[model samples]
Target: MQTPSFYFSRICNALKLAALVCLFLGTSPTWLHAQKSLSNELRAASEQFLATLSSEQKALANLPFDSEWRYDWNYTPRQRKGLPLKQMNEVQRKAAMHLMKAALSNQGVAKAEAIIGLEYVLREVEKRPENDTYRDPENYAFAVFGTPDAQQPWGFSVEGHHLSLHFTVVDNKVEFLPSFFGSNPGIVLPGYVQEGKQVLKEEADIAFRLLGSFDEQQLKKIVLSEKAPNDMLTTNTRKVSLEKREGLSFGEMTSAQQKLFQELLTVYLNKYHVTLKNQELARLRQADMNKIYFAWMGDREPNRGAGRGHYFRVHGPTFLIEYDNTQNGANHVHSVVRDLTNDWGEDLLKAHYEAAHKK
Candidate 1:
């Protein structure tokens, strides 16, 4: 029997072959329509954003594609390397937002904005000092990797407290992984600016509804433990590794249960542009559903006691989705979607390098 490594090697080889073919094809119509459409749009937006920045701001915003900094991603509150929104003038900030809007779907754009807005909510709730730098919405940083071009490899990242969005475009294919969205006070109460707003409402509610539908045996198979981890197992790690695959398989679930699970998956997958989302959906459909596992930890009830530690994750051959609400008295939330084989466009970059060296 072929080992997992063998299968992974096969996939990589196939991707390399596809990359070579694409390189020689001089831009296929399907590629142009599906991948280049968004790539070109984002490239144009990125150029416009750079155009508005001064030399120093441009220096701060641009980085080499292969820079180690490209892989340095975090959603924690800290000093990061990029042009923060606070430093941008009104025109520059608008251009920066336009670049961001070009990459996300309407729903995704809303969630990102809401996550940034939550900084204000945190300021009021925590009653921090006036000079508290961490709670400012404009603290988010934007950095571009390489020069944006349709035929070459390039990418960008928009990261800040509670959010990290990375995009890589190569030849017309785009890879989005290691994308994160987090919220403190996951569910804003009636008193905040956006009262009763839950940025990740569907992510939480849909999982709970699916868990509620599970029978005793199903729950026994799915619930890995009663205590949740303080944060995701892969928390900001460059390479993700899950210690075990323990959970109820998708094949074991009822048809309705499976449907609900798929819907939950869509909440994360749909955050990308339509073309990328559809491509990922196609890959998911083709994957071995029996290998997909849904595991839950901590209290099953929602909005229960403070810091009760509720967490769950969906793991499969290609993707990992982790949701944790175990910090800040169980009011904080952190969720991430990672492509097992392609985070930071690793696979595509490999293929591009090989194609470039081919005699």
Candidate 2:
């Protein structure tokens, strides 16, 4: 029997193969229009998860859909407002994971779990006590903005150290953006149970490949600086704007480089379930690719063995993707994908509210 790792490792290849099959068959994936089905599943899983929670837990897990806190998101190991896994019992924890599985693709779920598990490695490296609570795998908090309903607008988020994932559903359409996935001890060294584990390895490696393919002239267009930023430029902001566009646009890339760029994008987009994945990819495909920009900073090489820092971002009309590995001697990584116009499902919410007012 093949393990989950086997399938996880094949995500990029599978995506490429799926694209080829789509082109050959002249039909979209069967799950392309499965948004409503996914919405129903999310509703059911959320209901079940809520059912397992006590009254106190429910109070913490549920929030008004219009609450300002819905936009309050972070990937730091700090106190959060949602119901943490540490507060859940065995049954409740299982339900929580079911909700996660409902919202994320297998690859996305694996990355989240792996990021959480890194707490153990970090604790060991820091020589923390066995009972230390600072570096904890169970601190991830789950919060539901508004009740889960099929027709009404609602949202869900699961966040904690190195992970902040948000999803919003309205009128059967789902939006996933302003999503963050990070890794500390990004590459686990030897002397650990899962040594050499890099949860966000593809996110880093793909960009490296694209950068290496560029010639000196090509590099000048994309490379922003020799020093990487200490953190994401847009760190946890509620809104994202496309300011002065900088870096190399897709129109400038050669055919081969463009292929690498698209593959790099698929690594992030395919993290969602097929429905959301196809929906977002279709929208991006329809956008003007010439306007999409790729910028780089810091070391040309990744310096995998604790050396210089590096950072890059893919910014376009509809979305933005930022990746940074400038902390902890470039051993920690932070990557996020944000929607420029519809983050937190603002576009849907605006339309929903506007229609209601008209009614």
C-alpha lDDT score of every prediction, in listed order: 0.86, 0.87
What candidate 2 gets wrong by more than 4 Å, as runs, is 1-33
lDDT of 2 by residue, 157-256 (tens): 9989989989999876688888999999889988976899999999899999999998999889898998999998999999987586789999999999
- What is candidate 2's local distance difference test score? 0.87
Worst 10 residues of 1 by lDDT: 19-28
The positional error of residue 175 in candidate 2, measured at the CA in angstroms, is 0.9
Best by lDDT: 2
Give each model a TM-score. Answer: 0.90, 0.90
Encode model 1's per-residue lDDT on 117-145: one tens digit a residue. Answer: 89888888888865679788889999999
RMSD of each: 6.6, 8.5
Point out where model 1 deviates above 4 Å.
Answer: 1-32
Which pairs clash inside model 2? none
